[model samples]
Target: MPADTARGRLPGFFYRFAHPALAVVSTVGSLLWLAGFALAGAGVALRASDPTTAYALFYYGSLVSLAGIAGIAAVVAYLVVLWLLRDVLDVLDWEKPEPGARR
Candidate 1:
């Protein structure tokens, strides 16, 4: 088998750097989403006492939540594309050349 043909193998830079970077992004996205929900809840609690403040909190919280969701979606889409490409490459057997062929 070629060096790149091992199952679950990724390029060195991707495995070492890109994957970890995406993981961190995913973690941050989730945290931001959670914070948005907390803020929105606070807005709801304050709605009766301070309508203007509540509206601002709700609006900003929704924007933050949407941004977080978009970030996570983008990361997931990238990963899915990577997975599909890997599967297609595996199916094509592109890494294995003729047995006697020279490198």
Candidate 2:
């Protein structure tokens, strides 16, 4: 077993970072997305009177929304990785390298 495969589970470093990553993606990401929605709605409301400001707000909202979407995507990716690694953390002998082969 190599250092990366310590104890047949994900690296300790990954665990240490995963918590903060999930927190940022799940919490802050959601808040940003909602804020984007609010801004875009405000833009729509003001479009008739102030097209300039409304367009600016709409542009900003789009950018913020994209950022939020990226963050949320990261969270989903983390879930998928965790799901794939579930057995790795559970079963110690799930994988056994074959060192000998005759071909």
Candidate 3:
């Protein structure tokens, strides 16, 4: 039987929901990282005009960039875990006979 038609429904449900949710999170993280780069650039420009304010902007921008990196790493780690689960499921399903496979 196909993977989706397996007796246990939990794996199917997780495969359906988790993939898209992770994709959304990864996309948002990438956007945040890009925004951080822009902020850093603005901070550089401000450095020439106002040294004190520029320092604050640079500090906060670095923080934002670090957060973005963390988010991306988390998403990647989760995806790897999901892939491992999928492989395990595939192995189990392969070993088990389908509904009417046996004579």
Candidate 4:
């Protein structure tokens, strides 16, 4: 046998850092998206006073919300896939490269 030539798993702290950072990033991204919702709400609420301005604000706010949500979802999905892949690699002893090889 080749003695399972893979290197040892990454430290728990490293995994912790990766996961928490991803989560924080996801949350911040989502909050950025929610800001669009707030802006839209403000625009609608103010429409009674200024229809033209409020209409423009609402359109921009909706666009921002859509873009923000899409971006956040993409990022979160990517991170989740990486996290899952890491777990699978750990389970299968695939995280580390072959023996005697650079990472």
Best by TM-score: 1
- Per-residue lDDT tens digits of candidate 1, residues 39-98? 899999999999999999999899889888988998999988777776665543336448
TM-score of each: 0.68, 0.62, 0.64, 0.56
| Clash pairs detected, candidate 1 | none
Candidate 3 clashing pairs, residues 3+ apart or interchain: none
Residue-level lDDT of model 2, residues 1-103, one tens digit each, is 4655656454344455636558656667788888899999999999999999999999999888888888898898987776666654653344433667422
Across residues 1-103, which tens digit of lDDT does each residue of candidate 3 receive? 5666556664555455536677657767888888788888888999999988888888888888888888899999987776676665453333444787852
Model 2 steric clash pairs: none
Sliding window of 10 residues with minimal summed lDDT for model 2: 88-97
lDDT value, candidate 1, whole model: 0.80
Compare the candidates by lDDT and give the number of the best one.
1
Those runs of model 1 whose alpha carbons end farther than 4 Å from true positions after fitting are: 1-18, 89-103
Decreasing lDDT order of the candidates: 1, 2, 3, 4
Ranking by TM-score: 1, 3, 2, 4
lDDT accuracy of residue 73 in candidate 1: 94
- Backbone Cα, N, C clashes tallied per candidate: 0, 0, 0, 0
